[model samples]
Target: MGPITSDQNAYAYSIYHLILYQKMLNNQFDTLGKLLTVTEKQVTGPIYHGLFSTAILTAHNFLTEFDKYFKADSGAAKEKIVLVKQALKPVIKEIKKWKDLENFRDHVLAHNFRNKHTGYTSVFSDSTFLRYDIPQTVSDLAILIQCIDFIGRAIQRYFQAEYDSVHTLIVQQRSGQSKKSMTVEELEQYLNQLNQEVRPAIQELDNKYGIEVKGGAGETLDHDRR
Candidate 1:
């Protein structure tokens, strides 16, 4: 009804970016799942490496963006933060425990630095070499996807007015469509419909690829082995 304030604009942009990265992460994993199924072989070499690299980078982007909006010091409303944290406590905790993933992303994927001992690129050193656990990473990414889905649903449900207004404006600007925002009931129905469509597909992939979220003790990457 009125011009969107800067804070609202920033908040909306953060949500948009989170959704974008989340989808990218999901797409990467989905492709990986299908490739594994078709090949029926253990992950190896360039194709798997390429997909895994993109997945981890997208995951890092999602987690950092999520922190900016939902962390304690974030400018997000206290109630909204509380709601998100309460809903996603387990997922957030698991994500925080993934220091190895963060380290790999920072040192290997996102930056270029030399090993202190070898004075060579840090990509493959006896001390700095990090071997990813593909199964574990897949499980962790699944949990991250759950977090993203829950946060998206919570924002839509709790901040219906702002979400609707922002979404409507975004659609209009992007497509030049005069589409009106959905009513609360419509939003709820749409979310339910989306869940119905997405859940089975994910489950099928999981069943086909044996990708279960094993909450067992295992490092995401082996940083100790030479």
Candidate 2:
């Protein structure tokens, strides 16, 4: 294996979090869609709002990390927020769709207090709480998903270029004795190592959180939860 630099580590970390959050957001969407079939607003509304805010914040964090570590000037990476606004210029429409959601994030979800025009009737009054009334329909969620997907694609494009360069370097290195594919025995040993590492972690999750990793396409439920 090649030595990983700080920049590569940062990029890997950002990609991991981005994919994990996207999976979580997808699962949330599945649950919300099912719940909406039975009871739309009463069950799905709060969940949608919460997960929507989380998804947006997750995407923002991904972009922040991407710009900070991946797109930074190699000589002057200490520069903060470098090239981020310029990078985002192509996605302005998607960003505009998030304006009200951003407001909800700032006022109700993230801060839980007043923004410029929210969370207060009067500063001195006892009635200072405001309702979370952002209208998040399925269509709205679809738009949000589109924006997140766009960001993911953009990040992928940036990484693909880097990957191509790395691939060329690896190809050049392949003639060396140290850079060959693993033997069958080596692959088996690797699988055994992975199984040893992961099985315990999966069991721990099952024990502590009632979660499971069923090794197939079908979903299984814990009878206790039902």
Best by lDDT: 1
TM-score of each model, paired residue for residue: 0.56, 0.44
Candidate 1: residue 156 Cα off by (Å): 4.5
Error of 2 at 222 (Å): 13
RMSD of model 2 against the true structure: 11.6
Give each prediction's root-mean-square deviation over alpha carbons: 16.2, 11.6
Once fitted onto the true fold, the runs of candidate 2 whose alpha carbons sit more than 4 angstroms away are: 7-12, 35-46, 66-70, 74-92, 100-103, 111-135, 153-226
Please, what are the lDDT tens digits per residue for candidate 1 over residues 1-226?
A: 3556765766665666666666566565566556545433465456665766666677677778777763333555555757765876776676666566666776566654344334456654463534543224444445655565565565556656665667677777878756778999999899777766666666666567665544312212222322
Q: Write the per-residue lDDT of candidate 2 for residues 83-193, one digit (tens) a residue.
A: 434565566456454445445555544554334464343412443222433335655555565555665555545454444445555567776757678999999899777
lDDT values of the candidates? 0.59, 0.52
Which regions in candidate 1 have their CA more than 4 angstroms from the true location?
A: 1-3, 35-41, 71-77, 112-226
